[model samples]
Target: MFKTRIILTAVILLALVGVLLANMVQRMAHLHQSDAEYLRLFKEVVAITKQSYVEQVDDKKLMTGAINGMLAALDPHSSYMPATSYDEMKVHMAGAFGGLGIQLGTKDGNLMVEAPIEDTPAFRAGILAGDHIWSIDGKPTKGVPINDCVSRMRGTPGTSVTLGILREGSKEPLSFKLVRAIIKTKSVKAKLLEPGYAYLGISEFQERTGEDFERALKTLAADNGGPLKGLVLDLRYNPGGLLDQAIRVTNSFVGEGLNDGLIVSTKGRSAGSEREMTANIGDKQPHYPIVVLINGASASASEIVAGALQDHKRAVIMGTQSFGKGSVQSVITLRNGDGLKLTTARYYTPSGRSIQAKGITPDITVEFAKKPAQPEKKKMPEIREQDLDGHMQQVGAPKDAPAASEPSAAPMDPKEQELLGKDNQLARALDLLKGVNLLKAGLK
Candidate 1:
């Protein structure tokens, strides 16, 4: 009886294995058939274009354009970079490039200026964020690829390029003739606001931004004569840079307790693209109040840092909503020194919030505006009883001794006043930090 039972079980197992093998073979055949059909279609189209196009097209150019079209169909951030463009990108990541110092993006098929790097030609030429690039050096840019636009704008140092811009409030397109220079960006700028308060502006993340951020923090402390009480991290107009640098910057303020020190995580179809980056155990800032200032131009790594800190309750986010750019692109260097930047994943904050099309909203919504002008001191009418005609006099009290004049406030520092006058968002962040510090000390 036992031998008969074993024989039945073996026969059942063999039948199950046969069914699985048959399904695998059928799926493989289907995939092969589909792939061949697509390849044939692509070849036919290429041949037709080469033979009957309006103009003679180079084989390399045709292939490059095809690759670009494929990537563009996927997303805006993904693109194929030829060897020259790839080399330029490497230089750009290293924090120096010869261009107009303006970051570009696309919106509804129109080329738009993302942000002008601080102190660059584009910035100095009054290029504002959200301005549409109508033409580049007399050539229409409506349908040009972003990489081609960038290449056209960049040239040897001291060269000039004219951009026709369409600003929101302007009736006609404005022209800006800017002389390009080698743009060497200083990523971090720090200054002490008061004895215990500091301001750190990260223009953009770069190769050494993390290390530079740490050094700036130390410098702030030294300038303040002790540990900082509060900080205003200004990330306005900061189009983001390297991913690892963003993580490193976040690690400076966050310690290893909340959410298991999870700063950010990425989710993708492939296992290799999915990842979680956590804060390492190291020297971190004390439990000081922080207010991170972001604007509509803050994107990518900027969103990453803001999201992480906001999730951990480590800082108060201020300013307008951030420029939502949560997708991660992995740049793969191809043979022949060309490259491909492909969108691999979408990153999430510690709280599992995705910042893709939706941006990081600030805890405090402060719009950008100039500091209001101080009202003129109106002269009093002097309409007291003493000044009234036929009014009763103070018989005993000696003519109500003129009210002692209040001491005038000490003059504000010229630089501080200038800064507050220009940046109302930063001014608001400073006020909030000050209020928080006062509350912590039980004085408010």
Candidate 2:
């Protein structure tokens, strides 16, 4: 009876295996058939274009265009970079390059300025974020690929490039002639706001950004004479760079106990593309109130840092909504020195939030506003007691007794005043941090 039962189970298992094999074979056949059909169509189109084109096209150019078109169809971030463009990209990632330091992106088929790196030509030229790039050097940039536009803008350090920009509220397109320079970006800048309050600005994430950030934090603490009481992490106009650097920056503030130190995760169709990056065992900041500032220009890695901190409840995000760019790109270098920047996966925050098209909403929504210039003080009519018609001296008071002077508050640092004056969002962040510190003290 036992042998009979075992035989029946073996027969059932064999039958299931046979059915699974058949399905696998059938799917493979279908996949091959579809691939073959599309390949044949592509070849036919290429042959026809080569034979009946207005101008004689090089074979290499035709192939390159085809590759670019395929990648462009997939997404904006994915692109095929030729050898020269690939080289330029590598240099840019190395934290220095010769160009007008404006990060570019596409919005609704229009070329848009993502952000201008601080102190660069583009930033000094007043090239604001969200400005539509209408033309480059007087040539229309309507359908130009981003790589091509970048090439046109980049040249010798001393050379000039003119960009025609269409601003949101402006009636006419504005022209900006800027001289390109060797843009060596210092990723992090730190300052002590007050006795324990601090401000740290991350302009862009680069290869050394993590190290720079750590150094900046230490500098801030030293300048403040101790650990920070509160921090305003300014990520405004910071077009994100290296992914690992972003994770490292986020890891600095997050402790091992929070979400198992998971900073971010990625999901893709392929098993190899999916990944989870967690913070290392140590390297956490002191528990303090933090306010992270982001604007429309903060994207990719910036969004990652913001999302991670937000999910952990480690920082209060304050500003306008972020520039939603959560795609993870993998750069594959070809043998011929060319490269392919492919969007392999979409990253998620620790809380399982995919901020792809939907950005990280700030806990406190603050719009960008410039502090209005102080109006020139008018000369007040001096009506002193001695100048008044019914002025009378006290019986025992000295004639020249100095008026009782009120205690004056400490004067603000000129640099801090200038920075806060121009940035309303930053000012609000400082206020919030101060309030948080006060509230914590009160509760204790």
lDDT of each: 0.82, 0.81
lDDT of 1 by residue, 89-130 (tens): 798779777888897899999999999988999999899999
TM-score of 1: 0.70
Among residues 3 or more apart in sequence or in different chains, the pairs in candidate 1 whose N, CA or C atoms overlap within 3 Å are none
Give candidate 2's TM-score: 0.69
Per-prediction tally of clashes = 0, 0
Model 2 local distance difference test score: 0.81
Query: Which residue runs does candidate 1 get wrong by more than 4 Å?
Result: 1-16, 96-184, 256-260, 370-411
Q: After superposition, how far is residue 296 of candidate 1 from its true place, in Å?
A: 2.0
TM-score of each predicted structure versus truth: 0.70, 0.69
